[model samples]
Target: MGLTHEFFLLRSESDDEPVEQVVLSDNLVLYIWDSFRWIPAFNPSTKENHVGLNYHGITLIRHEGANLLKDICLSWSSLFSLAPSTLQLTGDFVMDENGNGRYEKLNFTRDDLTKPLTTLAAIADRAFLENYIIVHHGI
Candidate 1:
């Protein structure tokens, strides 16, 4: 199989609750609760970073109607680093409920500004885990 990328979000069927946008790609899986504005992007080996346009908070909580949302949320964060030209993933994970998450490394390289910035790309198909702890905490 080849490397695949996708964007996702967890939303409530009712309007009384807030929606959660989730992003699971390779060794990184981010959960944004629509409050902190900080979407998490993690790499099992190199580093993990969250992407957002602004810096709100690392977490957010919303209580609307008769429902309460108590889950990991990212808000109020900005993508300070320009989108990396590449990503280097060093692990594998099942980030989705249906067991469709990808695991690998991404190499992010800088571009020469004049070449029409190349679309960011990631490398997949490698497994480099320190142990079960890496999978559990995902730090």
Candidate 2:
């Protein structure tokens, strides 16, 4: 089985009744997971409600972290090189029975995922504005 990551927007970190799910492909989430990290100054773990973005947990991005996260999402175009490995990604950890990295096959360029990534960036911008909190539910 493969893993997936889900994103959500919340008015308050404490409020769970209303969370807007940010639609994005699991492939995009998994692709970016390896490089995603906290900005240290944020010291996310020091917060009671925060958690590190991991393969099996939830993570929260607030204020400055939101802005930094936006930057990270926006830079994915050049941050990764999946073009050549899209069709035939070969590696024991990557290749599945189908001969592709679980969902690592990037049949299209980052251009295809740019829109959703941009959308996430926009949501992060909102989080920076204190209008929302970015919640990443990882698989």
Candidate 3:
């Protein structure tokens, strides 16, 4: 069907703080098919299933107390591009303007996921959490 990935801030394994995880899915085939009324087709020239989509893998940044920040997921096509740095920068701005003056935690919602690329960019831009250890998953 599709791949599902999650990112979250985790406290110590022994700590009691609840992990606030954000989840995203890669369902581009479905999205494009429904949104554009077109289905993916095989490219005889390339000998590949041509959906013309590229997806970002999930990554995590860890901090003291075992806390973590999930990097953003992204996708791109010949006509469109979504970058991790972009999301990271946006997240930094969102935090500066609306976050609680701290980068210790980040939050997002399902509605945010309706636009996964933009949302992940916002999360990655969390500049305050720069010191955390980065963990990559599902590459």
- What is candidate 3's lDDT per residue for 1-139, written digit by digit as tens? 2465444433432333433444455343233323211213223334554332222443333342122112213332311343332222112222455554643322333333346544433444442255322222331
Write the number of the candidate with greater TM-score, choosing between 1 and 3: 3
| Residue 133 in model 2: lDDT | 78
- Report the C-alpha lDDT of model 2 over 57-88, residue by residue, as the tens digit: 66777775778777887787444434443333
Top candidate (lDDT): 2
TM agreement with the true structure for every prediction: 0.22, 0.65, 0.29
RMSD per candidate (Å) reads 17.0, 5.3, 17.8
Q: What does candidate 3 score on TM?
A: 0.29
Q: Where does model 1 exceed 4 Å of error?
A: 1-12, 15-23, 30-84, 93-104, 107-139
lDDT, each prediction:
0.24, 0.62, 0.33
Candidate 2 lowest-lDDT run of ten? 84-93
Order of quality (TM-score):
2, 3, 1
Residue 49 CA error for candidate 1 (Å)?
Answer: 27
- Model 1, range 1-139, lDDT digits (tens) per residue? 2322232121321232322222233223332224323323333233433332122212211112001111121111123134455534345454777877776453433332111111111000001111100111111
Quality of model 3 by C-alpha lDDT: 0.33
